[model samples]
Target chain A: MSENSGSTSTNIFVAKLSSYIDLSIEEHQVIEELTQNSMAFDEGQDIIFESEKNSSAYLLQSGWAIRYKIVPDGGRQIISYLLPGDIFGFRESLFELSDDSVQALTPVIVHCIPAENIAEICDSHTNLSLAFTWARAREQAILTEHIVRLGRRNAYERLGHLLLELLHRLQLVEKAGNSDYFLPLTQEVLADTLGLSIVHVNRTLRKLRNDLMIELDPKTRRLRILDVDALSEATGYDQSFLDQNEKPSRSPQDAIGFEEK
Target chain B: MSENSGSTSTNIFVAKLSSYIDLSIEEHQVIEELTQNSMAFDEGQDIIFESEKNSSAYLLQSGWAIRYKIVPDGGRQIISYLLPGDIFGFRESLFELSDDSVQALTPVIVHCIPAENIAEICDSHTNLSLAFTWARAREQAILTEHIVRLGRRNAYERLGHLLLELLHRLQLVEKAGNSDYFLPLTQEVLADTLGLSIVHVNRTLRKLRNDLMIELDPKTRRLRILDVDALSEATGYDQSFLDQNEKPSRSPQDAIGFEEK
Candidate 1:
């Protein structure tokens, strides 16, 4: 998707921020200056480099991306996935250059806000600073849950949890239907995210399909959750975390420019 | 360490919170009420339980603790370790009954402040609310780092990262010397934390020992990092995330209560 084609005139990012706290006209102007002319990435592109110093943070407009680290043995572990309206690459940049890389999992659009602007915002606006803190804390909670999944849950349970989480997040920005959502992921990509072998991922997918738990149509890139209750039970995921009352202003389609791909 | 020890008479909890924001006399009195008659736990005692509702957030007065979750198959994953003056179990309680457990890794004292009191403070004191937000965000950042470590890094790298993190945290609370820290963990516990087998943990520890990266005296429960540069190089850990400048008034030792154990 071309970034310019999907760019909204409504200042959805500012609108999103307003949901947390009211911003003055001057502060909004400052944010616009901070975000103006930020670059965007195509699907499967690298946004941040591993082991490189970073001076900016990206706000997701549309599509999906992942923050991950590569091991010496050529293994990749996806630490977290960024969805529409999600902000990433800031926590690392806030301290120093990130040790991990963020890659676009789908055709993605992002607002490249300068790190200096973020620091300024934190210094000037206590509310914005608190919002940033809330965002980071939520990120940490997700990671802790992931640790539990990786450390304790089996492959099937982990996959179930991942699906439930994605669906819930999609619902947050109104991207998901009542019982379904589009999951723009390949088996290989899923393997990387879930820390499973491709074969294992394929097997689990088949099992899920056979049990009428989920239906994925690769041709249309649509995911139909046939048994969400069962899946949630298996995953032990409660939707409360996903229903955090914070929503980004842009639609998932607008955020990712999914149609352009 | 008994809860009624003379040294524990001075409330480190209030002092720690004041580091984030200057609490008023009334606010200090409120905090004292919340923490009244809190108990201490010996090493290996559970602070909060899985599937139980805990109304209080703990301020670590002394020693170490861990937040962990258990799987149906009985495997455990230690999500994050709590140091002196660190708070845990409150955020989870804010939403629902606790979904995980907190346990003492060492004999520890903690001031149990009711979650309701904190919520009241946040509602009244904007600065305190901001401080709470920052604390939560910091916790999230740590969890995100752990996800990257466990999902991507090798056993040795994971071990290195874990040790560096523990030592860095210990140093923050002044529990450790300049270059050395006491790690009161066994190979089995380390294996569980790293999601590796005990055999793998032992082999990795031996490799690290042989490489002159670290020296572990299991008998003395002491860990001497021989080469900080090599350790950071191996773990990709940057120390900036450990910054506590916002609350510099509270000594890492006093705020975190490293001496309480």
Candidate 2:
């Protein structure tokens, strides 16, 4: 692994996983090796297509992507965001075909870990395996939140809730400041994600700005949640699902209790 | 395990998992023991409440449930349905608290597998562990589809798509016949699930019946999709995500290949 790539690509991952469990030097080395080789996709390019037989799981080293599907009428539903330090393709390992396609919303870089390597890693590295499980659970929680966002929330709550989520998720990987992140999404993208029209998304953004809930710089594509606690209270955005309080043990032998040994 | 409960409960799970990979006699026994002791909940009872510290994963032995969350405005959003043979709560193992609450839609029975037992089982039993992983992947796929349903599809498509999904998922565990099942859900439940109002859901169901796409008997609480192919095509309901075609190898030693030994 080149020292430059190792420091850049693997840092986001190590930062994310370190919150769950303290990694040993060997574990850190394994992650660095796993993410050394990388591939890049330009903005608007398809990273992984739907129904494809993908044999490897990918680690998103940098940039932004979306996992999405198209309805019969050609309407797209953005399933979830694939941010830095996020893992993908692994979920497709046991499936016959990929359900949703992933696309790069911005210039994106990733490291592919073949299925065999994933299985081997999980079998040998208990700490890494547990971290993967934790990641999956976190992803599920986010999807559940998204479902609720679309199913119940109005345009304003939906937009605010989503921004809050991005801010917190990006903050975890040091991709954002205390309450701001580089949000390279078009109003159309936000519309597709929030189940609204572009006009509606635009109106909602204006309302949020007028209401002092958020600030979005169109040129820089950066968003800042001015009052996160108030917006969270107004929108029912709970960060507890994304935050881990107790450090789980690295091995199954010591996982019985909820404390790190 | 009593022979009667064993035949009914474990059979569904065995039937579901058997479609993915053939289980050894010992694996069947393990499932049987895991489900032998179960707790029952009456209709309208909370199976697992939101924010509850859950220490055990659950196996749904019989009846139906819904995983849902309430918005700040008291609006409820049903995230996903928990059917017989479905395993849950394990997803909560890594999270500090449950993100959503699970409620019994009918008189429900579930077996609790403690967190420690889950860790030990996955550590020792590679096949069962893989099966769990497969189940998690399938659940994630379902959630992804739900997001698409909510975000992209109209009321007609959403209602139709969800019914097709339930039909296929229920059929996987022998809980449904060729094209019909006992659907014990009210219009309110349907409204919460499909992101529509009760009046809208009722109107849509009537429209579906009028169009000869479905037959829902209110008296018996049974639903029959007259032509699944037509409905699926119309609603963009793809069963490929729920259906398993490839039998993955049970052991990681042999998982490198696609086919089962």
Candidate 3:
């Protein structure tokens, strides 16, 4: 397990799980051992392919990965991005065939946890099972937000909303600064995700730069959100979905009606 | 438990769970007890609200419901339409407050299973816990498909795609004909869901009707897919994601690439 020597104890998986429940020392040890035995992939590599039998769940220990589906006629749709600490192959665990393919967007380190290990862990540890469920719920929440962005927002709003999403997600791993983060995704990938053409993505990005809402340095693949307030205002972006406040009781005066509670 | 007189043995929740796992007689009895006492809501009633602490998960026993997020200054995004057998408020069980609001689209009967009851069932029963996890995983798969529709398809494709989705889902409960299903959603709801304006939605529906692809009777709110193969072909609709094919020993020759696994 020494392969991941530099970053096992303080991994993003722990940070993410800690958002849902307190981990025991043994659980942390399991996590460290789980991550230490990982495989490495280069940028643009295909880690898992669509329709493949997914016998293991891949944990993104570092770098970026994306889940995408290709059309019969050659078009492609990028569904979700796997950030550090993010887990993929969950759907495969539930069902049989893989519905989409996973690709590495940057040089990535991934720990492949076989299904038997998960069963053993989940069977023996109730807290870990609950944490896994919580993680899946969070993923569902994120996907719900993505659907709203794709189905309701315009181009500029979509771009800003995505940037805000990235910022908040990166914040969980303490990777984001006040306004900047290294985003390795290409404009092509962004276009695929945003349901826009590459040219349109370029133009919208230029508009954001012109309006001082964001600064994307193509050479360095660095994104600096110039005016966070303005970007948020432009898109009506909110971060409530990312909150993991799982406590149960609150005021009954939450007033369940047409208004959001 | 006498309130559930007619369909105690073959309830939707049990049926849905039985799709993924075998439920013993005791588990079935538990589900029947859980659903016997239910509350009814009229059409247009809010069942759960966003940000309100969710105390119980609601099981839709009859009619339709939707999960929607109301944007600032008034705009509603319909994220998911809940069918008769569908469950809501699972997010609340994992997290503290609701992330979006659930509203009844038609007169509905819902059974609220308190969190403690769920805890009791899941703690004592491993299979039930696994079935619960399976249900949530299916929801995630549905959301993944929705993201693809919103981000990759055009308005016509989106509408056709959604119709096909309903047809397949309704078929699960023996509520759909060869190519027809009762869809109670209005054009406004469809517009909101497809990320198109009301007028645009109307135009798109008219085109589909003209193309002899669909027949939507406004008065009856019944949708008939006159040409199922063509609609699926035109829209690239696939239903593999919704299948519960959990048998693991498939030929690993499922294609691999820059896609999802």
Considering every candidate listed, which one attains the maximal TM-score? 2
Task: Give one clash count per candidate, in the order shown.
Answer: 7, 0, 7
Residue B249 in model 2: lDDT? 65
Write one digit per residue (lDDT tens) for candidate 2, span B205-257. 99999999999999999999999999999899889888777777655353322
Clashing pairs in 1: A61-A255, A62-A255, A62-A256, A63-A256, A140-B140, B84-B256, B85-B256
How well does candidate 3 reproduce the true complex, by DockQ?
A: 0.45
lDDT of 2 at A227: 96
* Best of the candidates, DockQ: 2
Better of 2 and 3 by DockQ: 2
Q: What are the DockQ scores of the candidates, in order? A: 0.28, 0.71, 0.45
Error of model 3, residue A33, in angstroms:
2.2
Question: Compared with the true structure, what per-residue lDDT tens digits does model 3 show for residues B52-138?
Answer: 767687788888889999877488898988988887786677565346888889988888889878867877666666667666777
Better of 1 and 3 by lDDT: 3
Tens digits of per-residue lDDT, candidate 1, B70-185, equal 76567888888888878776675344423678889988878776765765575555445545555665676677677767766778888998899888877655678978988888
Candidate order, TM-score descending = 2, 3, 1
Write down the TM-score for model 2: 0.93
lDDT of 2 by residue, A79-172 (tens): 9999998998788876664568999999888888898788888888888888888888889989999999999988988999999999988887
Cα-based lDDT for every prediction: 0.71, 0.84, 0.79
